[model samples]
Target: MINLKMILRIMGILSLIEAVLLLLCAGVSLIYGESIINDFLMVAAGSVIFGGLLLLMGKGASKQLNRRNGYLIVTLSWLLFSAIGMFPFLISGYVPRVVDAFFETMSGFTTTGATVIDNIESLPHGLLFWRSLTQWAGGLGIIFFTIAMLPLFGMGSMHLFSAEATGTSHERLHPRISITAKWIWYVYFGLTLALTLFLLLGGMNLFDSICHSFSTISTGGFSTKKASIAYYSSPYIEYVISIFMILSGINFTLFFYLAKGKPQKALLNEELKWFLKSIIVFTAIFTVTLTYTSPYGVGESFRKALFQVASLHTTTGLVSADYMVWTPFLWALLGVIMFLGASSGCTSGAIKSIRLLILGKMTKNEFKRMVHPNAVLPVKINKIAISPSTQSSVLLFILLYMIIFVASWLAMMAMGVGNVEAFGTVVSSMGSVGPGLGLCGPVHSWNCLPDGGKWLLSFLMLIGRLELFTVLLLFTPQFWKKR
Candidate 1:
């Protein structure tokens, strides 16, 4: 049976943590001398009260959690965080509609980076900071963030980690899961700080540097300016963000190994090797295309190609130039990149590189088996044979991912969205990548979409951010049956 009381208690703790984050934004408001401080404070107060009530109701609950409780808790927690996270926007009249507020908040927490706001710079510094914070906090994951603290509260994090952690295999840098989380956070924080310093040196102000650093390290594309990185028009800024976006797309566990003086182990990762190779290949293709077709010279084309390829490949969604106006072939290539996504266990979303790596191996093995009916050919990754179950799981995941994409694409078209826009939006939403083709392109906000479309995309973002099965499994009838 599900551990209902324990789930409530844990959610209460999460709400309190969220309240603290809100207060930090309020502090930012104070620093900026913005009157929106009251809006943040009011929401923070509400979070505290709501959290307190949950704690009271969950008093004396058993601490034990099963797989069922873990999945349910993770899904509900995301919804709960989004529900509470929307209030500051609502109270401040920034995102006036309930659907708009929820969609924006969900996008922030999921690091999807889609926005409805036309004038991003007009928002107060505090709200912008909060918006970036949501992405940064969610970069690794919500449950993963509290793993270190979960043990302090007399709870084990194994089930939670199993349910919510990304990638096909969980890497353990340390024997203790909490220690592993801390080590990963150390890498995450260090990268964010390094990127911030680079942006500052590139002539960006401290606030913009910090905010963009948050978005970049999280592979989130929220910008403090209206025109995104294009507003700066600095080649140096573009290159720096491009490099950092690629770095952030790497699996955090690999960074841990490098940090621990095991450079060979990290360097030998097959997925990392393939991911880098893919970037170089895509960048080269883009550079050649833009160099010949556009007014940009080879150097400028290379710069733009590197930035755009790295951005979308990592699902960062920070646009240097609008890709929609590019050759149809180029934007189509970017759509494929968005679908492929970055390395697993990092900030970005979509079908991760590790899975793709496995899928490629599986396809190869199938062909080999066809050649020799009696011979056994096992799929391998990084020189280790992949289990049959894992191979099947990867295949099933890709199938379901495509199935949902088709279904959602049709649904969007039925909702009065144009064919091109509908296709782009569904792919973008399902992959948790910001910007779409046509009307919802990088230059435009998603405000043109109907309320129903926004809500549908919001659901897509949640499921995508949770890696498909975690959220989808909750809807299955068998998932609710007592074991």
Candidate 2:
């Protein structure tokens, strides 16, 4: 049987920690003299009470976690945390509808960068801050955060850490999973703080600066202004964001390597090299095309090309120019970028570059096999041959991803969205890339989406963020069967 007691204890602790964070938001409300302080207080109190009950009831539970309990805890933790996280928006009456509030909260936690809220500036400073904080929390992952800070999990922390951490490859910078989690958090925080300082220095107010920094580091594209980065109209702000978006998309494990004085090893990573190469290649193509095709100056064209490439490639989704209005070729270019996401083990979503790289190598070997017949040609990564099982897993993942995309596209079309819009929105949501090509394009928000469509896309956002397998594995009968 699963250790429900232990799972509940972990969830309870996480809830408690979340409630404490809510209180900090409440503190922000008090400082700003915002009318939503009462709302924050109410939400904080509710979280505390709910969390307190779980802690009290599960106090006698065992501390250890196994595979079953780890999956159960991680899945339930996100759902419950999202549910609790919605209270601020609900209580504040900023987003009165339960579905909309839940969608916003889920988007925030998933770092999906999609928003239903049409008027962002009208939201209270405290609520906005909480929204940004949710992205930061979800960016590093709440479960991993708990594993790092809470010591009660003991050796079992590895189970929870593996479940929460993105990517097929797990590299530990420290001997213990807890220490590894802490180190990653340290790097995440450092980057976020640095971005915030730069944004502040670039003429944004403290609130917008902090919020944008949170979103940037998370690769979550929630913006304080309606026009996003375009609202600033400052090339400096855009430049800072462009750089950080790329950085956020790279694997933090590589960051740990660089931090540990192994910059050469980090640079030698095949995925990182291919990732940069892809960016440069695509950026150059788009810049030249846009410059020649459009009336915009060379400098303006280059800026737009870099921003859009960085945005879609990193899955950051921050837009300065409306690609919908740009040449049709540029729009197609972004769609391609949307499908090829950031490096593995990072916060960015979609079919990761590492998987694609493996697939490319595998394809080449298969071609070689056809000609060589009996000769052995193994697929290699980092100068090491990949096992058949790993190759099988990557291929299967890609197949399933494509299947999901087609199904979602069909479903959205049936939901009354136009063919172009449906395909764009489905791919965007499923890839966690935020913007689509048509109605859901960079110039438009998902606000106009039907309720059914919003709910569908929200579910897709969660699925994509968890990487299809983790969430889909729950549906298997074997996953639920008794041991």
Candidate 3:
């Protein structure tokens, strides 16, 4: 019932591609003369051998995959990807521990930007490139990238696409899902390229520009320097990255609309409207808070607030300053934005804004329904009526997200972590918004977290990246029942 052969075959392909990406990183290491080249090659070789074996064993599985298979494969590939990707850190003795390496790689692939390494600058060029590369691959999603580029995966492409993509906000922009995938990728890569050029123009070096652009456009927060965006201390660079972070958080389809000269349609998108408004609202509030307390001038405070707010709003972990240094209230406010991540169809993680919009509408509709029992009232997003079933799913997702958040918080607290760290870590990790308050706040690495906390947060990153259902559904008895 599970399509084990098909799963293995597809996983093989995923691994092969992963190996190829690693080899590219190895090339960077070779050029930079980093000693980590051997670690990268060893893992790539292992990936190749294992992938070839899986392909050979599952030759019969080269068929169209069912919806169920898509879900399983997507979930399995993420797990396997993280599991294999950790080796460079482990084998190189950079991370030393399997759990630490796994946590780092998982955070990267999930684009969560949480790091266990205490000193990122000391890492060699190759390892740094690999670090940035993970987020780049993860930004749009590794499987999503595979489906778009590899024609062999055309069967069930939509199933894989839907299973892996975020939100129900937008459907295929193109009639053919593969075409839609390519178009989506064009926008993704185009944005990355444009952002790289912008950063280069802002005086960033080529390497930092490309690396930061990869993270920025993907909304993955991995930064090349220890101080993140703060390392540059250039207002121009900060503003450029801030703008792109906001742009990246937008649904990619909206870009497709703009490119197709449907700017009016894209501008009319309800989620886009809400997203822009939310950014403005958050930026204003955060700026006001900083202005009231921070020693910096009003303009500087607003700039800092805008950059940090955009970073957190998009779930990009790049920080312009140490947020923990801010007032506790402001720090808590950042946590709130972390919970309500960017637009649904983008890379940033969390409950997503579309659901928040839906929740707001649902709450208003409930009050209206209460006032007039017999009157017909419908909830609509972008003028399209939302069905009762869709509302139920959204409601359930929020409820489940909260439950898991609380459970993770409790679990971390139980592990002897402080309240602030536990709360911030759980919410940030569960939301896939790296950086939290107190000990785990901006400017803090996860090196201090206990082993259990690392593993727990790693799983949280995976589930958060998958948007919960794909991973959570595996535990349901119904998921295993054969039709």
**Winner by TM-score:** 1
Q: Which stretches of candidate 2 lie over 4 Å from their true place?
A: 152-155
Report the C-alpha lDDT of model 3 over 1-483, residue by residue, as the tens digit.
788888888888988999998998899889888878888999999999999998887778757767777888888988888999999988888889999999999988999988999899988877888888899898888888877755655345767887798465447787777788778888889999999999989999998898999888877888888889999989999889889999999988888788889899899988888888999988888888888888987888888999999999889889999988888888878988889888877888998889999999989988988999887888899899988888988999999999999999999999999999999888888777888889888898988999999999999999999999988888889889998
* Candidate 1: residue 43 lDDT (0-100): 94
What does candidate 2's lDDT look like per residue over 1-483, in tens digits?
577667767777888888887888888889899988888788778887887888777777876777766777777877887899998898788899888888889888888778888788898889888888888888878988898866854436877876776465788887988888888888899999999999999999998998999988898888877788998898898889999999998989898888779999899999999999999999899889988988878888888888889988988888888788888888888888989999987788889899999999988888988999898888888888888988888899889989999898888888888988888887788777877878778767777778898888888887787788777778888888888
Pairs clashing within candidate 1: none
lDDT (Cα) of model 3: 0.87
Candidate 1, poorest ten consecutive residues by summed lDDT? 158-167
Q: How do the residues 1-483 of candidate 1 rate in per-residue lDDT, one tens digit apiece? A: 887789889999999999999999999999999999999999999999999999888898887767788888888888998999999999999999999999999998888899999889889999999989998988888888888789888888877888888458988878898888888888999999999999999999999999999999999888898678988999999999999999999988888788779999899999999899999999999999999988899999999999999988898889889888889999788878889899987988989899999988877877888998788887778788989888888988999999999999999999999998998888888887888888888899999999999999999999999889999998999998887
Best by lDDT: 1
Candidate 3 lDDT for residue 270: 88
Query: Which is superior by TM-score, 2 or 3?
Result: 3
| TM-score, model 1 to reference | 0.99
* Candidate 2: worst-modelled 10 consecutive residues by lDDT: 149-158
- Stretches of candidate 1 exceeding 4 Å from the true structure: none
TM per prediction = 0.99, 0.97, 0.98
Candidate with the larger TM-score of 1 and 2: 1
